[model samples]
Target: MAPSLREGVSQARSFEFLRLGRQAPWLVLGLGLLLGPGAFPHRARAAPASGADPAALLEQGREAYEMLECPKAVASFRKVLAHPKATPAQRVEAYVGQAWCQVVEGNEALARETLQKALEIRPDYPVSPDLSPKLAAVLEAAQRDFRARAKVEIDLDVTARGAPPELGMRVRDPAGQVNEVLVRYRTDGEWREVAAHSEGASLWTARLEGAAAGTLPLYVETKNRYGFVSGREGTAESPVAVRVEPAAVSAALAPPAATGAASGTALTPLAWTAAGLAVATVGAGTFFGLKAKEEEARFNGDPSQFGSHDEALAVGRSAQRNATTATVLFVSAGVLAATSGLLFVVDGSHGPAGDAVEPGFAAAAMPLHGGGLFALAGRF
Candidate 1:
């Protein structure tokens, strides 16, 4: 016969009572008291879910959440919420945890949406209340930390002939922790960064807004996490002066400079003139040297062997005249070549010239002058 439900329950309770009574001392010892078959509680058993290690799994999910592992954290939290025994509070916490992970992963819009769902689960959730203050603190810290990187760019205008000017920077700070960096004007003082950041060997960039042209004073202040503020002052910064003159001013300046050049031109006719003089001097000197050699050859022979005394004297006089003329022409050529070279160097410094004087002219003239001098000495 089938057992009645009441009788079955009564038998079960009686067996439990008998087991407990015998194991009173063992119960006190807290061992082996519930080992007997009749001591088992009657409850429906459920199959273990796949891959479930609830405690360790939940802890892993929380760690991923803190590390901003959005997808993994969301998956884990979803798993926890699917558990049959998950309370309303636990479900709400899971939603909020997923939302925080999203925020850290830069999905602000999704984070807000997830947070709305969390709020729906508990109409007055602490997540929203707690998040506001923390988010505000982060933004404030970013702003304050970014302030130390303020920098100004300078631009200058000056006359073309004016002295090359340097840029100067002045920073004023009431506190002394921040320091100023000295920078030279690069490419007309273009926009540049004033600070750098490091993230575990990775470099991060800070944003720099546009800088206005002209002289400006900038201040930089830095603070530690504990709110100790210090500032530094830098030297004043000025733009390189760029000179822009009216057409009239440029025209007026042109004529006087041209007149000066005209007068200078009279001093140096043409490179060919100097070259011709040098060639003529060399030729004259060569002629004298040859004549001298001939005279010496004649003198070395018997005294009465070749020419009349008058003929020899006339040859000697001609050689001396050629030598003297060669000396004068060679000296003049050297002076002219030197003057031309100096003018060319000066013109090169100013700007592009219509005609560039070659250094070869001076080089050629030097050798010619030396040849002429040597020929003159030979004549003596």
Candidate 2:
């Protein structure tokens, strides 16, 4: 027969309880806590909470400051700054809040230091009216300190001559951290960059070789040692407009022939020299021709007036020789004169000088061996 109910209960209680009975509840609780809500049973997890939002922290900090809880405000602001997700504006706001907290606690030195951090983030950030007058004073002093540390000034000089455009810059960087300056420019095409060479402390120059003559859009960028842009005169989007002279452009585009003509010195001198030579030859020819004519006239006037036939023959021969000599000189003069005139025409046609003076020509015919000689002279 089955044991009676009281006896059975007592006996069952005496049998040791299953090990799970005491530990299972605690085990489940431990698992639930470790896995967190909605976590898979097989994939245990830590707590589900994420990092505090930077924007929320910033707001909370502002509220804490308004309530005059300087320590809590500073704690919230510091958390916002330490968060990686914080934006530049949020960072600046946090620094300002923390600085104001320091000022309220009578920690003026620390307050100025904190304000300096905010100014480094944004030098132009206005002092908030919520800040105490003392804090505002600290902020101003912090700004002055930041400016002293990071001030950058750029002075640019652009010179466009007939060749290429040259750019010079004087950078007043009190921090002495600027390592280089770059000249950014463009003509009709895309923007280009040329590295500037340092001439001395704060002085730099760059020559843009292929920059054409037109409206050159340009800007100067100063860089630090690691190539971080430290300063800018103008941005690439809104560059400084510089007008390049058209005269220089024209000269650059001119052809070699055009270049020679512009000077116009080469052929003009040669033409003049040829003309002078021709004049001398012609004068000599004329003198010989006159002597020949005079001798011939005397010989023809009286044959019997000669002492003998041989004497008359000699006189005639002498006249003929003179005539021949005159003819040869005349021919040479004519050739030289023609060459001079041709040279002058060539020079005037090609030269930058528009007009040339017309050369004069003279010709004389001889008795028998007669070819007229001509000489020409002209100003080129």
Candidate 3:
């Protein structure tokens, strides 16, 4: 018949002892020579401090287990578990190590209990197949029991419904430990937070209004009374998305606008009058200038034909008066044209219709029959 698990472990230890015992004679003589007869039985050293490195403690515990020191291994593992700054992974590993020691000591019940605590920290903790058959069987039993335990978690159900299109979220906190629930949502580019109100038994609701049509990313978090988050459905880094549809309207809406075309503005009457006056003065100035030239030409052509010196003087004075009249008319035309151009420019702001003409004047003198004729022109 095959040996039991404990019997097999005991037999293996016996074989290791026999192998070491072969060199014990020389080892004992050497130790006696180094420390007199008083060192026949050595005293055990003090345990490591609780504040020691958890990883170091865990390694020490594993080495003790390999040397068949179950009690010392258990103590080292407990120190790792008791460390204040021990990580979850480290604590879980320590618990597993203690459970292995308990299994080797023939305490299967205590080993199973220890394994359950490790599973509480990490339910997916693997049961290594390389473990001894007795320890593997104990680990499998603990995993089965852990799965059969009751579940306590928060649940969130989201729906986009209702008139005017409000987003509704239904939350359930079965553990009854959640003090408050909130939803963080984003419509365009900014994220917003809203508190949820209790609606019914194990049911809470949050309504979000005025969301545009698109994919909205959101997350739900349940907090304790102290404002620390206890449970969460989604996170800010990885948010859940829901579709928002556009609202529909009836076909029979309001009528078209009453005024469609933009009102236009024309040049004022005052501006038109100034322009007309400018043109009339230019025509009058040209006529007077031609008359001045004709008078001078006739007077110079025949001095005796004038019939008398007085007539000739009268003709010369008449030519001088015509020339002065032409000069005055041309000056008046330039002033009138400038006024017209200024008015046009001011009125141009009312509309964009005609080209802008700059107001300017040019004068030239030509010698005709030993007499000068002045000509002036203006643009408006």
Which structure among the candidates has the greatest TM-score?
A: 2
Q: Give one digit per residue, the lDDT tens place, for model 3 in 215-249.
A: 77888887755454645767789997765545532
- 138-201: candidate 1 lDDT, tens digit per residue: 3233334333332222211122211122222223332222232322222334534344222221
Stretches of model 3 off by over 4 angstroms after superposition: 1-51, 123-137, 153-380
Q: What is the TM-score ranking, best to worst?
A: 2, 3, 1
Deviation in Å, model 1, residue 30 alpha carbon: 48
Task: Quantify all predictions' global Cα lDDT against the true fold.
Answer: 0.44, 0.70, 0.67
Q: Which stretches of candidate 1 lie over 4 Å from their true place?
A: 1-57, 127-380
lDDT of 2 by residue, 1-380 (tens): 98999999987886646655887668755643432222111223234324589867876776566556678878988998999989877887798778767766778789788877766555556755544455557877887777778877877654343456665567888865477788888855788899988899777878776777767789988776544566788888899765554555534433323233353547888999999999999999999999999999989996778999899999999999999999999999999999999987787655356544343333222111123323333232
TM values, all candidates: 0.21, 0.38, 0.35
Give lDDT: candidate 3, residue 286: 88
Better of 1 and 2 by lDDT: 2
Worst 10 residues of 3 by lDDT: 249-258
lDDT accuracy of residue 59 in candidate 2: 66
Worst 10 residues of 1 by lDDT: 361-370
